[model samples]
Target: MADKEMRAVYAETLTELASKDDRIVVLEADLMRATGTGPFKEKYPDRAVNVGVAEANMLSIAGGMSTEGYIPFAATFGCFATRRAFDQFFLSCAYAGLNVKLVGTDPGVSAAFNGGTHMPFEDLGLVRMVPGIDIVEPSDPVSLKALVQQIAARPNSAYIRLHRKALSPLYPETATFEVGKAKVLRSGTGVTLAALGGLMVHNAVTAAELLAADGISAEVIDVLSLKPLDAETILASARKTGLVISIENHQAHNGLGSAVAELFAEAADRPARLVRMGIQDQFGEVGTEAWLLEKFGLRAEDIAAAVKKALKG
Candidate 1:
C-alpha cells in the first residue's frame, strides 16, 4: 500500500522538481492546503503563489509567468480549473504556446461531498478540444509522482487530472511510466476493460478478476493519457478481444469513453463493439465516493455486469 497520500506525493514531487529547476513555480487559487501544495509553498515561499479564489486570475498569472521563462503549475478544483477558467487556459496558455501545468484536483466523483457544482464531469472533453494540450490522469502514488515530474519537465501546456487521496499502490516502486501511452496490467481475450483515474483503473482490474471467475477473459488497460489516446496498445487489445468497454469517473459523453469511440470510429475496419460506462450525462450529486460510483454504475461489480451484458450482445 502507498504510505503517502497522493497530495503529499504531489507536493513532494513538485518540491523535488523545483529544487533542480528554479523555473518551476507553484500557483494556486488559494487551494494550497486543498491541493496539498502547502509544503511546496513552505519550502519555497517566493516561488509559490496564491491568487485567492480567482481561478481565472490564477491562469492568467500562470500564463504571464510562462512567458517570462517560468514553468508554473496552477492548481484548483476541477470545476473551477476547467469551466471557470476555460478561456484563460485556452487562450492565455495553450493558444499562446505557454508551458503551464494546470492541475485539476478532485476530478469527477472524487469531489465527493463537494457536490455537482464542484465536480468536473466534462474536464477531459474541454481539454481534449484544446489543440495541443497534454492530458494525464495518474492512477497511484508511484505513477502520480512519475507523471507529475514528467509533466513539469515538458515545454508545452498540459493538464494534470489529479485525484488527491491515498490508495493502495497499484504499480511497483520501480515502475516506469510515459506520457501518451496506456499501461496494460492484465491480459485476456474475451473483452477489453479500458479505464483511467485511480478508482476506475483499480476497479477494472477487479472486474477482470470477476470476469475470469465466470470463465471470461478480460484484458485491463489504464488509459492514463487522455489526449493522444494510445491507439497502438488499445487497438491491439480491442482487435484480440473483439469487444471494448471503457469506464471512467466522468461523463459518458466526452471523456475517456468518447476518446475510445473516436479512435474506434477512425480505425474503420477494426474491432466494432464498445460499451461506455460512466455518468449518463447527468449533474453530479452530493454523496459518498462509493455511493456516487454505485449510483453511476461505475463500481467493479457494475463493470463486470456491463462486460457480461456486452458479451451477450
Candidate 2:
C-alpha cells in the first residue's frame, strides 16, 4: 500500500504543477492535511489559501480568482464539494465556465472509517449533470499525475474525484492519456470489463485470474474520463468481446454503468450481455474500506462473478 499510493502521487504531482505554473492557486476547505495539500501550502504559502470549513465560500472565492486570470484548484471532501456547495459550483464555476479545478477527495467508500456522512457515492453522478463541467476519476498514480498535468494546462471547469486511501499503480509511466478517450489495457475476445478509478485495476486482475481458470479472456478498459466517455472504444470493445461488465465505486444508476448503457442503446446494436457492478443505488454505511467494498459487492470476486454471469447469459 505504501509502495503504490495515489494520494502521495497526487500531492507530489500537484506540487510540481504549482511550481511550474505561476497562475496556479489552491484553495482548500480545511482539508489541506486530509487531501495531502500541506506540502503545497508550505512551499507556496501565498498561493494556497485555507478557507476554513466553508465549502460554498471556497468555491465562490475560487471562481472569483479564476475570473481574474488565475487557475484555482479548490480541494475538499467529495460530500462537501458536491452536496454542500453544489449551487455555488453551478453558478460560479460551471455557469460561468471558469477555469477552476474542483478536487474532491475521499469519494465513495474510500471515506471508510469516516462514516456514511463523509462517503460521496453519488458525487460523480451529481457533478456529471452539471452543464459544461468535465468529470474525471483517475485509476492509478501514473494516470493521476498525467491528469493533474493536463488539467493544470487546460482551461476548463472540471471536477476530479480521488480516493482517500492510496491505490496501486496500474499503468506505465509513459502511458499517454486523452481527455475523452479510454485506455485498453488487455485485448480479449470473450468479455469486456470497463472500469474507472481504483476498481479498474482490481477488475483487470480478476479478469486475468478468471481467464486462466475458464479459458475466457477478458478485455480491460481503463475509463479515466467519465464525462466525455469514449464511445468508440466502448462500442469496439463490446463488439469484440460479446460480453460487457462495468465496474466502479459509485452507484450503478447515473454513473459509469448508466453512461455505458445509454451509449450502447443509442448505437442500436447488440453490443453484448452487459452487466453493471457497483453500489446498486444504495447509500454507503460506516465501516472499513475493505469491508464496505465487500458489502457493496465491489470486490474482485464480485466482479468476476458478474463477468461469468454476463458470459453465461
Candidate 3:
C-alpha cells in the first residue's frame, strides 16, 4: 500500500466535519501550519481561533467555548499540550466533563529533528492521570479520518496523539473503528504484540513477520485507543497466546505497556508474561525517525527480540 499524510487528512477531515456541524470549532496555538489546521482556519475563519503560541490560553479558551455548546478542537505540539497546559486542560475541560478535543501533533519520535524540548514521550501518561479523558492514536490515514470525526461527536473530553507526517496505510479506506477497541491485524498462537500510535503499530506488524520466519508465531494488535482500553480483546489474545509484548513510541510507564499490565493483573490467574518495549525513561533527542527508533531500541528487530525473550522466559 501507499503512504498518506495523516496531518493533511486530519485537516481535510476536520474541515468537512465543521461544514456539517456548526458546533465544531478549532483552536491552534499559532502553529497552524505545523499541526495541519491552516485549512480549517481558511475555510472557517469565524470558527478558527489562533492563540499565538499560548497553549494554556488556547486550552482555557477551548474549555470556555465547550461550555457554550461548541465542540472545540485545540491543536498544538504534544509537549505543550500535555505539559504546558496540563492544569487548564484537566481542571477546565476534563474535570468539568466538557466536550473539548485536544489534538497533540508529532508525538514522541514523530517530532523528528525538533530535538528534546519539542518531543513528548510522556503526554499519554500525563493525560491519563486526568479522570474520564479518552485517549487515541491513529495508526494510518483511514483511522485518523474516522476517529477525528468520531471523537468530536462524543460528549466528553478527548486527547489525540497525532503523527504529522505521512505513514504507511494499515487499513483499507472502508475500515471502520469504535473507541475503546483494539484491531487485531495478525493472529498467531505463540506471542501477542500490542502496539500503540504510528511507529510501534507498524513496527509490531513487521516484528510478527520476522517472528513467523523464525518459526515463532506472533499476534499483532493495533491499540489505537489507550484509555478505555479494549481489555476484553487483549485479555482474550493473551490467554490464547500466553505471552504479550507491548510496543509504544512513548515512555513504557503509564502507557501501552502499563495499560496491558493493569489488565492482566486485574484479570488474575492468567499465566501470561508481558514485556514492554519503549523509551526507557530517557528524553527524546534530535535525530531522524529511523535513528531514534534504533537509539531507543524500538525497531522491528527489537520487538521481535523482545517477543523471543518473552517466549523463552
Per-model lDDT: 0.91, 0.84, 0.90
Per-candidate TM-scores read 0.98, 0.96, 0.98
lDDT of 3 by residue, 1-313 (tens): 3798888989999999998999999899989889778889888999999889899999889999999999999999999999999999998899988889999999998888998999999999999898998999999998898888889888999999999998989899889998888899999999999999988999999999999999998999999999889998898899899888889999999888898888888886874888888889999999998999999999999999887776677
The TM-score, computed over Cα atoms with residue i paired to residue i, of candidate 3 is 0.98
lDDT of 1 by residue, 111-210 (tens): 9999988988999888888988899999989999999988887889999999998867888999998899889989898999999899999999999999
Worst 10 residues of 1 by lDDT: 1-10
What stretches of model 2 exceed 4 Å from their correct place? none
Alpha-carbon shift of residue 111 in model 1 (angstroms): 0.7
Task: Supply the global lDDT for candidate 1.
Answer: 0.91
User: Candidate 3's error at 214, in angstroms?
Assistant: 0.8
